[model samples]
Target: MTSKPEKVRWGILGPGNIAKAFAGGVAHSRTGTLVAVGARNPGKAGLTEAFPGARILDGYEALLGDPDVDAIYISTPHPSHAEWAIKAAEAGKHVLCEKPLGLTAFEADAMIHAARKAGTFLGEAFMYRLHPQTARLVELIRAGAIGEIKMIKSSFGFAMPGFMPEHRLYAKDLAGGGILDVGGYPVSMARLIAGAAAGKPFAEPDEVVGAAHLGQSGVDEWASALLHFPGGIVAEVSCSISLAQDNVLRILGNKGRIEVADFWYAGGQQGGTGEIRIIRPGDTEVVEVKEDGWLYAFEVDAAGEAILGGKQEFAWPGMGWADSLGNLRVLDKWRAAIGLEYDIEKPAKRVNTISGRKLRAGGTAIPKRSIPGLPRPASCLALGFEDFRTFSSGAILLDAYFEAGGNLFDTAFVYGSGYTETLLGQWLKNRGVREQSVVIGKGAHSPLCYPDVIGKQLTQSLERLQTDHIDVYFMHRDNPDVPVDEFVDAMDREVKAGRIRGPFGGSNWTMERMDEAIAYAERTGKQKPGALSNNFSLAEMLEPIWAGCVTSSSDEWKAWLTARQMPNFAWSSQGRGFFTDRAGRDRRDNEELVRVWYSDKNFGRRDRAIELAKRLGKSPIHVALAYVLAQPFPSVPLIGPRSLDELEDSLQALDISLSPDDLAWLDSGSDQARARA
Candidate 1:
């Protein structure tokens, strides 16, 4: 591991024109020093004369590992930004990469996640934002220089006199496009203005729509986008490589307008006059922002100070983590609107994690347990990933889970309207971990609950999941109105037909019905329910969490599960945030938490869990999850984590071992006297 430095010793990854400009800024920086320049080949020529003191490394990898370097500035083309940024973070080097942060928001998210996992700094290099001029502009707008802001108009475009296919600006293979290149400037500024109007660091567009003309190379040449923000503020942003635009920023309000020419560059690298013009109906006011600081030096020092200050991100005026993510998301939408997709965004190219490394063997292995009829043991903790909308988003998380020794995924026919299943399938195929993984697919949910609909929905689910057989299939909801015989026979037919090749069960089913189905199955020689998926948490459910939910936390139900020894693929295993501090009695904001896991008995259990957690040096939520894992029978708590932090937090339970007495006290407080001993 690299030691922290008082002054950030910076390394330039790609010594191109942008890197040279930034090096000039570093020469003027207060808290930063240029230490090394890394190139593709072993050349001591171009960058050395520019900076006589800096060493020239043979390759980017060498620079990343250089003991003298404290941080890295990635000035490579747009395509490699995410990859190198992630690699730098993995090497424990702070990263400041040129924008856009990634070709798409998904890549941006992965880069951010990688830095977080590595405990390093990662920032998008938008030097304009770190300049004092931007702060003043925001301050002026906040002071109502333009009262009741209504519209924003900004453009950053330049005409390439000759559109050579090999040029970085026009090359399709390089992810060349107006939206992904120069367009981020106008969009980011618009968001900053919109955020100043509303009271935040930055705001994402509520709606984005755009149109662009694709060149012969299948990349967007020029594009225009309209962003609708909150409070009826609209922003018109445009960019191009082959079209000459005014390169101006205009913020119009109800009473006046603020205008700036070439706002991004401010004055020049050396700084001259950055004038902000306010034009009212009858008068014109000019605010001159003048400083001798180099334009890029401000960003270099900003990153240096943040790193030395032990901050993972830059302050407001500069793009924070969320701010960069929001900007990239808008760019993604704009590119999507214009049908601009880079070759890298395709599934064929996105098979690996953004960090290009597996997350397994990270010192903690997710404990695995065997399920009936599976070829191999699966993780005790199952992941329900229904929130991701894109393949990259889902793949990143899935990759983390799979590499962490988690081989069970909970998916459904109705998740994301089948898009979730499609993404999971893509991840399974991409990762080639299908046979090693257990997929719990649920279908025939409420409103569509029928014996006959199961097969049809299962077929569609199989197709979406790109698998012919589901390892662990379940009926999402039970229909008592439909005879248990029909349900059992239908499931048996499917089992015989090999649609469900592993454990088959029912989710949200009553214990009485499950027993009845098992009896019927045994009597008729059909497949009996192998597992159950119900709400089984430390806190008992008082009311339904959702429309049709069942809780197996009752004493009788626990006794039944213990006696039968059936593995329950429990949902909402963390009590749906019940054990968390957010579930206090006074915090009734979450009606669902109040409705389902909000009784005096459950609160008493929560208190006991908290008390035990304090003794165990863990959180009440961790104790709650540990209680589930220590059940008398097989209990695989289905955990849903949207990000790496949440996933790591959930994994903390794997280290907590709750004995039978501890579990008894957590469940009923009967063994508390012995537990404390």
Candidate 2:
């Protein structure tokens, strides 16, 4: 690990109260430094009134677009976080967006995806979780100091009746509400505590019930929610702006209980000064842990390290985009239960027309299975590992899939820095399964799209695969401006050079483009693309993955594939897990993922999938995979499983056989019914 600096360069977005205090905290930190201030009005930045020598920028765009700005700290309103953070990530800047990363989980996923694509860092700025004292509390709780946690109670509120309702804190248009503003703190803490009890980084509540006192501004003035964990751990949390609260957190277990005072904004007005106490059964004595100084500095350090070290997201517990999304999903429900609906949650503002797809909260790892009837491949290699360099898990997943009669390994040069290919190479070497297996490789992914990249990436991939040529190759994207002849000639050259053999496919390309390419190839006497790799789940895309790129799943595209006898390696065959409602909402960074993977139509499909899963005695995820595998044409679904459990669940589609009537029924639901109202 690289040693943390005595001071990290920091840029602040928006000049709000949180930003002010955060800047102050950074000024006092021995390991952080405030470098720039980005506000809508340059004159209003007033950095001289806070931290001297901190330059003020004219706008948020300038802060992000500036090459000198190493990392950005977004303290803007919730709605703006998603827009600005995405722009920042695209500009190659690391981001630390405020709590509740975006209004929804899909938004957070988009932000994460953007950061991943950019090779930058991103994290929800939940300063309190990073306090040294929070870690100590978790350590004690994990050590059984609190003994099997069973219940939790926490609250954060303050009465300010005389305050104007237009302030950002009370403005519904700004996503103001007790749940998002204050409830998030306690809820995050509960998840952290619950996850620690189960030896995981996080926990999804099984159920959430909410009630709130609404302010005239239409936001939650006071709100309370109940969270049920799988292992009998139930937690109650409350927050309010119209009433004073204890701002305390307490957890009860079989053998003991733990409590924290002022849990959300733990540190005192100036910085860290919060306290936690543990009370064991039959012991009146209390053991307390004290935290010192402003906690936001830790978030700054995390973003700094990620940017300088090239990490996709922060490693802190209870502070990832996923955590933020989970917390918001619960909060959205709690607010709804309380009749505290922000303008943002209104039907007009949501991308999906439906109200909200109900989720099965709670950490229930139900076994997921794939439906049967996929075209017989040489073998089904599990092309699912995320980190290909890590031999233990990656190779283990491959072996597990191969041992189960799967012999075709799918990979891309862009995956894991060609680490996936390297791992596959080493696995082949170790098992001597090279000739027995078929290799599928893809290239030209984001950030690596040079035409020359095809040959260069292919050569490196072959070297890593320990093979002279690939059995199947794919153009991961289509450059609309790069004429058909150019692409065909390049692939044909590779085929003739013995670098790639047999068939080639197209991913993220449209039918017109594919048709043109094949036409060009046929006229020129070169091999045309023999496969299509686009998203072909039960739910199709409403828009292109990116702004300009279109998916090759339209009728025309499908017809082209069918006409030419081209098989499809359907990317996201399981609708990217949306059929199970596993695909979350948007976030501040990875917006593209949210738009492409988790739209309203997809959510609607997932809602129906869940109902069908329950009716069929199968997991919703399995239903989704089955839907993908049920396609009429010759299709091979690409699955990204992180563990044996996920791999097994994704494989459930192998057995399910959805009739044409069943598929049509699913696709033709009240189109409006799919709208998350």
Candidate 3:
């Protein structure tokens, strides 16, 4: 028994190039039908004249009111993509909004909210994602065809100087620009290939630094950026609106590389033309594919199946609204870095949804007032963390932090066994905000820092972070065996490759070694480390607390910092919760940490912290955190808060101010200090 293919009647808004393609696509598809076309003016009504069987309405509202239309395909200029889509969704029409999903994630959020409220299906028209070829590519990568994809290089752009101003590609009012116009293709492709390592598309580029060739209208006609994905997969993505390129997409892995030709959405142009070339260490083969007729048809079918099944959006794992938002977030950052702003999005549209459910950037108020060892006034949002678990709290906290006003983030690869780096990668997605954020990445720790670990770990860290480069990368641990020159050379290579953004630094290294590293970079004509992340605290440690622990809390260290212009992001700025009493002195209970950095001196410091905690009418943790924030240097403490309550509790210390005398009294002769005396 053969079941009849279900038909989804579509109402297309805006009679443009995309609309015609979609109309022609329905004519060629088996699962959907185009029933109506809407135009803003009668003069432009000719845009849909080819669809003789379908009615052409004078306005979008007329088309939405048509009972026969089950859905609306939004092919309007970029600026109107969200508005009309939300209207259609509110009218209970399934919506397939065109790519660059919306002018911003904020706009996209509105449309999504409306769809959810109206109980309608709303999907971003990322036609390429629905193509059979893209599906196969995902399968190959997931199957490890390219063992552990470590890097991806892709580009899509073309020159168009002779184009008309009314063309959406050149109109600022249309939200036109290379990044949002064509950048979406390569950026989205990068997200597809990076997979779970990135956790989401638009892996919050740990850092997005780039140069652009701007057009007469101030739109980026050509721009280049590097996206670092988790586990060391770097996607060097570029795009140009004014010139043409191969539009090649390549995913580089440890074992091989996967290259796709003309990887964007191509429907009915060439029925069966492109090939995906797989090149291995020793073998090379080109796999060909036939377009499954119309590319948009697949999404139409997916939309139909989803709506019929009572889902608000397509449930495809990677193509969900979350993924769409991620892509937009990255695009948002790329545009921001290049100074590209669309006038149309100046005052973001109001939420039409019942929740008045607009997307608001969360986490307000700087956490610096409460954090310690910070050298400068805290930015709106500063991402604070230790080691790799980069994405999890660091990334999640950063998102919340940024929504609140944070702009700085810190990370090191060895912390989460790379999981942290991976997490950071996920946090950086389609927000059109990169320049405003601060990223600190570290390399060379554990099973890795034997000199041989430098290059691979840094590259891997970049990929995990999901940006082309690291804003600030550090040497996680000093390897005495590796000549300082060797370390400098490796980092120098990345600097040249444009993999590490300006302002590099060191972590867990002594001041002497840091001086040696800075000298080596200078002598070699390479970039010098600009920041330092060390065990700096309000309380001092006399002797080694752990087997390999290092601290730069000495007065000499402060003098050195004052002399050097380098910035510092303090680690364990809160003294490992020893000051908070959240961590008890009984090592038997917390063996893991006790074995790492616990000591009798730290316990004594903990006792004094408790006393001070009482005097301040604050928690020991808050006093400890306040102590770190009291430093005169430009420093920020890396706090580890597991819940919002803890985060809020930590945040409460922001208003607590300590005097220089208070600092002196707390540290002058605490038990740890007396022992040293």
Which candidate achieves the best TM-score against the true structure? 1
Q: Which 10 successive residues of model 2 have the least lDDT summed?
A: 353-362
Which candidate would rank higher by TM-score, 1 or 2?
Answer: 1
Put down candidate 2 lDDT per residue, 1-677, tens digits, no spaces: 95744445778898788888778767766556778888787785355687577888888878877756777888888877766777788887777888878665545655665676677778887877876777877887789986789998888788886657778878988888667877888888888889998988879898999887776787777888899989989999888877898877888988877777776666664564556677776665455544555566666666665656656677765387667768877876675577554676442343221112111112122222221212224432236555433443355456556655666678888788778888788777756667766678889775565577799888888888888988888888778767867888888899899877668857777777788888999998998877777767676776765544455555566666556656677766665545543455534244645666666666666667877777777877777677655656666677777545566666666666677666655655654533421
Cα RMSD (angstroms) for every candidate in the order listed:
2.6, 21.2, 15.8
State the lDDT of candidate 3 residue by residue for 311-407, as single tens digits.
7776654367888877877887777677777655332322122122332443456743322322333462245545322122233334445655666
lDDT of each: 0.87, 0.70, 0.68
The list of candidate 2 runs beyond 4 A from truth reads: 1-7, 267-274, 290-292, 345-677
lDDT for model 1 comes to: 0.87
Per-structure clash totals for the candidates: 0, 50, 62
Q: How high is each candidate's TM-score?
A: 0.93, 0.54, 0.52
Candidate 1, residues 44-106, lDDT tens digits: the string is: 465678766889888999999998898999998997888899899989999999998887776
Q: Which model is ahead, 1 or 3, in terms of lDDT?
A: 1
The parts of candidate 1 lying over 4 Å away from their true place are 1-6, 44-53, 336-340, 358-364, 671-674
Predict model 3's lDDT versus the native. 0.68
1 against 2, candidate with superior lDDT: 1
